[model samples]
Target: MRINVLQHTPNEGPGTIKRWAQQNHHDLYIYHPYQFGVLPTAEETDFLVVLGGPMSPNDSFAWIMKERQLIQTLMEQGKPIFGTCYGAQQIAKTLGYAVTKAPYKEVGWAPVYLQSTVIPGVPPQLMALHWHEEMFEIPREAERLFSSDLVKNQGFILNGNILGLQFHFEPEAEDIREIVINDAEYARHHNALQQSPEEILQMAIPPENRNVMFHLLDFITK
Candidate 1:
């Protein structure tokens, strides 16, 4: 399968998703619209994975708007699509939902409570990395999958093929370090839900996190 990844930043690459693709013997291609202004066509992409970024989906950048249009097009064709953070917001916005500031700027490791068992093997409550100020509204027809203390709409699944996750389950230790270094300002924020850089880095990446990510990937593609 030709899996096309939409990467929005230099640091937020396809961490464990790449590992999953390698293990599953699927080809993975990453495109950076923010840097190159290029995206894969629906015909070239068998599956779509949109990575996280610091940018908001509400931004008026031409690339952002264009990416949303592509997401919409893929949805219309019943192609499998998965998105995280800003990518999730893009999916929601494309589906005519609003992407607005979350009640709190959730950063670092937080617990997300499962609202449904659409994706098997996920624990009832699991810790996931979060680094977004804006949140996507749960789409009209989508089933809400998870929620956190600070954010009500943490994840949603649409039509069994489209998944939107508001937190990071793919980032490894190095990926988290790079994210913290690139967005140091957000890491330093003192908040009830936010964690310090040291804390975020020190917390071990739970084995279940990657396992759950892999399960979701398989579930979406199946």
Candidate 2:
């Protein structure tokens, strides 16, 4: 399958998603709109994958608005899309939901429970990496899939094809380290809700997390 990826920043590239796509022999074409200032047309790909970034969907940046437009277009065309963190916010904004600052910044390994198990192979509760200060409201008709103590809407599925995730399920240990190094400002929020870099590194991602990611990918592409 031909997959188009929208990478918002240099450091926040597709981690586990890339590995899954390659192992499954799927083609991935990434467009770095932040670096190149251009977003590729999504018509050519069978699936669209939007990765996370530090920027919010509510930002006034011209490129961000354009990216939202692209997402709107893809959804109108009934294109299968998976959005993570900032990407998920973009999806929610496009669906007319409010994307605002979360009450508390959740940074580190956090546990999220599956509110709905419609997405096959996902366990009822699991720990995933978190690194964002913004969250989105669940759009109408979308099933709430994941929810954590800090964020009520960690993930949702709309029309059974579009998946929006507010946490970093695809990040590996190296990916977390790179994000910490690149976006060091997020680490300054010292509180019980937040975890230190060393602490986050010490926490291991469950093996089923990657498997769930792959299962979701296959389900979306099918």
Number of the top TM-score candidate: 1
TM-score of 2: 0.95
Clashing residue pairs, candidate 2?
Answer: none
Model 2 stretches with alpha carbons more than 4 Å out:
190-192
**Decoy 1 TM-score against native:** 0.97
For all predictions, the C-alpha RMSD in Å is 1.0, 1.3
* Alpha-carbon TM-score of each model against the true structure: 0.97, 0.95
C-alpha local distance difference test of each model: 0.92, 0.86
Supply the global lDDT for candidate 1.
0.92
For candidate 2, the clash count comes to: 0
Q: In model 1, which range of ten residues has the least summed lDDT?
A: 186-195
lDDT of 1 at 21: 99
Error of 1 at 189 (Å): 2.6
**Tens digit of per-residue lDDT, candidate 1, span 56-90:** 99889999988988998899999999999998999
The CA lDDT at 121 in model 2 is 75
Query: Taking the tens digit of each residue's C-alpha lDDT, what string does model 2 give over 22-92?
Result: 99998988998877887878678678888998888888889888888888888888889999999999999
